[model samples]
Target: MALEQLSALKYGKKTDLSAKLMNIHTKLRRYAAVHSGHANMQTTLCALAVDEDERAFAVNVGDSRMYRCRGGCIRQLSTDQSLVQMLYEQGRITADEKKTHAQKNVIFPVLGNASEEPQPCITEIIGGVQRGDIIIICSDGLSDYITQGEFEEILALPMRLPRRIAKLAEAAIKNGSPDNVSVVGVSMV
Candidate 1:
């Protein structure tokens, strides 16, 4: 199970909210244990401190990634815990082979492990969210079916948040997603 959290404060210092962030992340991980398939899943939490005062948080898990699109470039804030990733790191697999690997879908780590230290990997990004900054969280199902360019195109549309996310999910489903697909997009005002 993985715990996911999203929080923001406009006036207070972020250091004061560390405890709250930790608590929220703990809860999200507990929830994942109850719902996700892998009993020993490992989760990664990707968060960002939005605004100059660093007051926002975003949490995520599994292969569902959080992307930051800024300065005309996109960066992935989360890493996938899959065998394919391992192979890639070991130089046993190539970028092209990553997609068709026999263990591509296997999650290497997630939440609910029976280990002693049961902890979720957390990432915190500081600074404020700019007007044009884009935050996207989505399952691998969407990434697998759509090209990066296609995703950029879909996200670049002027549609509302719900509609845009729905469209992304629909696209993945139409492209034959064998697993559940989920996506969340946030743009700071």
Candidate 2:
């Protein structure tokens, strides 16, 4: 459903990206409610859209993340909407503590939350995606096992995007990621 909405939005003008994203969330919520019996099926979503002017817009739900690497440095662009993230944001726990927290995997805002509307974080990169910048979107299975510094190093390598993405997935698997790992890499040319 999300992909269908996104595909429909792709042909339209870029001015209404956020509204389109919200609509997608609403549609997904409706679908989930209609299929409430399959309660175990839930998904984290993170999407990025780059315009012709190099502006980037992102919408994220759950623990999946978006990262931007520029000038040899990497920074996360999406905030994790999980219990541990809330605890860290509230200063109730340190970053290291949150990493090992018992509820690290407890994500409240997801695609199928029937009790409330999913609140996705929307971010706009105003001329921030310059040429040579690398954008990465990944699931928690990869981010949970890989550090930002490690992403920086991997992205900085003089390899093709596919190879770099493969290396990242391989590294996460080697690091004992128990969940499914997925990564998408886009390099601004």
Q: Which is the leading candidate under TM-score?
A: 2
**lDDT value, candidate 2, whole model:** 0.80
The Cα error of candidate 2 at residue 164, in Å, is 0.6
Writing each residue's lDDT as its tens digit, candidate 1 over 1-189 gives 223244443324434444554455456557656875645544444444443555554444346677766654666776666778778989999978998888888764443334432233346555435677778777787777766666677777788767877888888899888876877777766
Which one is best on lDDT?
2
Compared with the true structure, model 1 gives a TM-score of: 0.68
lDDT by residue (98-189, candidate 2, tens digit) is 87898888887576566666777777865567788888999999998998778888887798999999999999999899989999998888
Off by over 4 Å in 1: 1-52, 55-61, 71-73, 115-119, 124-128
Model 1 / residue 30 / CA error / Å = 8.5
TM-score, candidate 2, is 0.86
lDDT of each: 0.62, 0.80
Estimate the TM-score of every prediction: 0.68, 0.86
